[model samples]
Target: MAMSKQQRAAVVAILVAGLLGGAAILFTGKGGGSGEAGHEHGEHAEQGEHVDHDDHDHGHAHDKPAATPASAAAAAAAPAQAADQPHVIKLTPEQVQQAGIGIATAGSAPLRGSVDFPGEIRFNDDRTAHVVPRVAGVAQAVPANLGEQVARGQVLAVIASTALAEQRSELLAAQRREALARATYAREKTLWQEKISAEQDYQQARTALEEAQIAVQNARQKLVAIGAAESAGKDGKDGKGGSLNQFALRAPFDGIIVEKHLSLGEAVKEDASVFTISDLSSVWAEFVVSARDLDQVRVGETVRIRSTASESQAEGKVSYVGALLGEQTRTAKARVTLANPGMAWRPGLFVTVSVLGAATQVPVTVAADAVQQVDGSSAVFVAVPGGFAVQPVKTGRSGGKLVEITEGLQAGARYAAANSFILKSELGKASAGHEH
Candidate 1:
């Protein structure tokens, strides 16, 4: 179908006019000469509006968002919403792994509430002793050194005492007298039976023998009371008087010699505490509790103890709780007995004691590391369709490892358990970009 010349001419003119109009619109939009400034101002105004819109969107996203398709679409459409919405984060599985992020499922956990108190590790007083020589003496041989471990009845030092020598001499003399009196009494009895000795003679001899026996017993008891009888040998004799003045200071129990005050040839008093021995297998963690906290701490309650110097922890039982408060501090003394395996919990080490209270059953709980601070609120990075989402949470009681989520999260929700801080860092970067 061929057209006439006039019809073709009219079609060409209409095409030329449409092309020119489109070029004019494009030039005006690109800020052509006269309209350039107005165009730039309009762009700046649009950017300001975008910033304002984002700020408003972020405010609502941090609170609770309804679980609906519209909200989901809104969350997906806005990349900046990842920083604004508490329920959205933009990360692929590969990116999440590259960031060293870990996931944990929220679930029910037994929440053991606890109270903490500052404490100090100390020697168990029951197993600690200050060794003293009952008799004043000169230290002859100092065998035990400081920090040396000794068993019960082990000799710590040997002392030479004039007083001990005299006591032993008296015992020896009494024994000899008792033997002689026994022989004389027997001879007198025989003579009287034969009518060769008088009855009075036999009675005097018997009385003398009884007195001698009493003297011997008295001397023996004196030595026993002074801790000298054990070192006196089997026959109750001190090496036939050669070691009459020698007194051995022995350990009262299995312990380590923590203090040594006496040296060889040093003179010591009878009541002087020359050595301090303590058992390090177990130690006491002593703390003070206020009057209001007295009821919370009780004997036989299990407590968690942590060392201040290191990442060391142990479980202990409350051994003692004072009935009276301190006169000056107005606080009651409490103690926990902890087993010091390998003697790691040394005395004088500072510790924190956590007294566990009743257990609670929480419906939703996550690892403590999963909860991170986002926008100044407690939040968790929850896994969503394409990436992880920031879920604002209301937290309740928390143990060291797990924390209870009171709201804003549900059971079976996967979250970043370890290295969640990485996500926080990334979120901060994204927010900073938008801010600029």
Candidate 2:
């Protein structure tokens, strides 16, 4: 099993000659066939998939050539270059298409970026009203129910109050006094003109008439203040009996009643919020913006409002932006006025508001899905000989479906725009194999 010194010297000489030959090939690789040099290069590597398999298996020194200084340098440089090289996923163009990976050419596009904010659907305050009974009374009849729609002048409820009866009686008495004074003043003026009475008596009667007229006017005005009519029913005669104390409460405008606190025969206060009515034709999409992004959102800008509860989407303009932020939230409140013609945007519904910005054209861009995370870097799978190469890219502005690439890719370069995660998955598998 052991060789003599003469045989050992011959084997060493053969190894030394092989080393020199391999080094010449490595040094002149540019001029030689690359396929042959690649195989020869494999023979020189010390570790990782390039071990000298033939010599180790045969237990013979001559099975592989010796490695020289030039070959050593070249072999060491191969892996280092590979470490920095773009990962290549070997797949034919047909395979890429068959796998449902969408290919897109990176190019110029108009990018309209948007800032998103969480929001909620709210009642349009201008169209919302908290209905209150302006006069204290007992609710005799409540016709309007919660969530019922009512028109302007529609009777919402009927109330009975003894105060109303007293006020009406005062008005009637004032009118009677005014009428009596008017008759007396006329009689005194005629008597004065004919010298049948003293001028002082006529003047006194005129003053009494003026005071009575003022009292009648004051009583009528007091009834108007409480939303009561000066007279009851069409006959113009005051109500039969209890009708004088009855007050009919009417809706101020056409809207749906959202809340109701009054019930039949319930005693109510003068300032009780008996009902809440809101017009559903329009609503507010309220949102809060951070201080840093306050400059981006402004009045008159358009925004797309979407709801999470359903597939409801609508467009509206920024109607209001608060000048100050909340002390606890540190966020400025903003609202968009959305026309809810179908009443789809209900109050308390969650929504997302995407405030649109002005559009600008950029030189290089790709579909948003084309970009992926590659070793903490943004990269795209670019078209290569077999399939695609992981091309590192610096992303700039992003809009609807495209992202601006400021670097690492050029215009007209095709790349995987969809299902590119397949390529990333392949790269992961390759990495795991190498580690193992």
Candidate 3:
């Protein structure tokens, strides 16, 4: 089938157009980072461009892209706009999970004032005493042992002394003298009534009776003072039932026997110590306060004491805060008086003292979980209309689980208490995209 030249040229042109159109469609589909697909499609475009075609499909299709340059440029700038736009964190249905953010309204409670110090138990000096004999004696029988409880007037020991023997002799002689004085006084009265003796003789007899009675009275008083009972007189109990001059060391006050220095049958001097008694009804807790914390302390303020060695807490009032600080330790001494029940707060015991001070109140407080770090600053995630945002905040004093928010949030604001870190990471990724 022979044809003319114009018909053959027209057939070739149609064939070239169809091939160019197919190659342009392939380039549009492969402009992405897909290496092999783009490489092959670019090769197909180069080959089609060289092809001579009066009717070219790529010529028509490629012209459409140039028509919308402003639109494409604007579309390319969309990612940049997102980067410049303030971050709006989108939460998944699960991520939108609400966290229980604890918030508190500030109120006042008794600010239990407290102070801490290191202390040890000590005996009250004023209430402690040592039993000593007033006169030199030989220790006879020590009836009470060491650590024995004795009452006032309870005999601790009996001492036999040469001084005691002399005192007894004087007492007996004085008793005879008193009896003689009474008889003499009666004789003087009779003599005066009978007028047998002269007035001067009768007056001398009366003066002698009075002097003798005074001497007897002085001797009896001395015996009674040396721990003896007087006047077994008048009841026919006039005989010396007990040794009048035997020194009985008695307790001066109601207390516990802490030390016993004298043994039975041992010779004791006037200065020798027989027993030491401590009144345990009240005890002292000696505490050491640091120099920095000294000003917070005051007398009569209550404090709490506890020991690491045992599970006991004792309450006491500060009896004194030492005027002078320790030169070596640089600590002031605080004396606390605690009621020792059953002698539980023993002397030489180590304890910890807590002195509570005034408390400061704040108007607003939030949970520690609500606070998050953003851009190297402390912030919190606050729920907004569309999404959540990181808000910077200023904080003050902190307590357990709660912290005082001085600024950056108000009452009734919802904040994310948990899972805020996830949002932070997401924001970082969005920033990374714009960088690319």
Per-candidate TM-scores read 0.71, 0.62, 0.53
Q: Tens-digit lDDT track for model 1 on 1-436?
A: 9999999999999999999999999887776655778888889897988877876978766466557998878877787654455345688889988988888899998999899999999999988999999999999888899999999988888888888888888999999999999999999999999999999999999999999999999988988887885334422223344377888888999999999999999999999999999999989999999999998999999899989999888998999999999999999999998888799999999999999988988899999888998868999988888878788999988776899999999999998899988888877777677767
Clashing pairs in 1: 86-390
Query: How would the candidate models be sorted by TM-score, starting from the highest?
Result: 1, 2, 3
Clashes of each: 1, 0, 7
Tens digit per residue, CA lDDT, model 2, 1-436: 9999999999999999999999988878766677677778676654544345655666776756878999999999989866744387889868887899998899999988789999999999999988777778999888889999899978888888778878989999999999999999999999999999999999999999999999999999999887877765511222344377788787889999989999999999988999888998999999999999999999999898889988777888999999998999999999999999888989999999999999999999999888999999999999888778889999998775789999999999999999999999988887776655
- State residue 392's C-alpha deviation in candidate 3, in Å: 20
Give the C-alpha lDDT of model 2: 0.87
Tens-digit per-residue lDDT, 149-232, candidate 3: 789877787776667667667767877877887787788778888988777767877887888778878877776666544432
The best candidate by TM-score is 1
Candidate 1 backbone overlaps, count:
1
| Ten-residue stretch with the least lDDT total in model 3 | 231-240
- lDDT per model vs. reference: 0.88, 0.87, 0.73
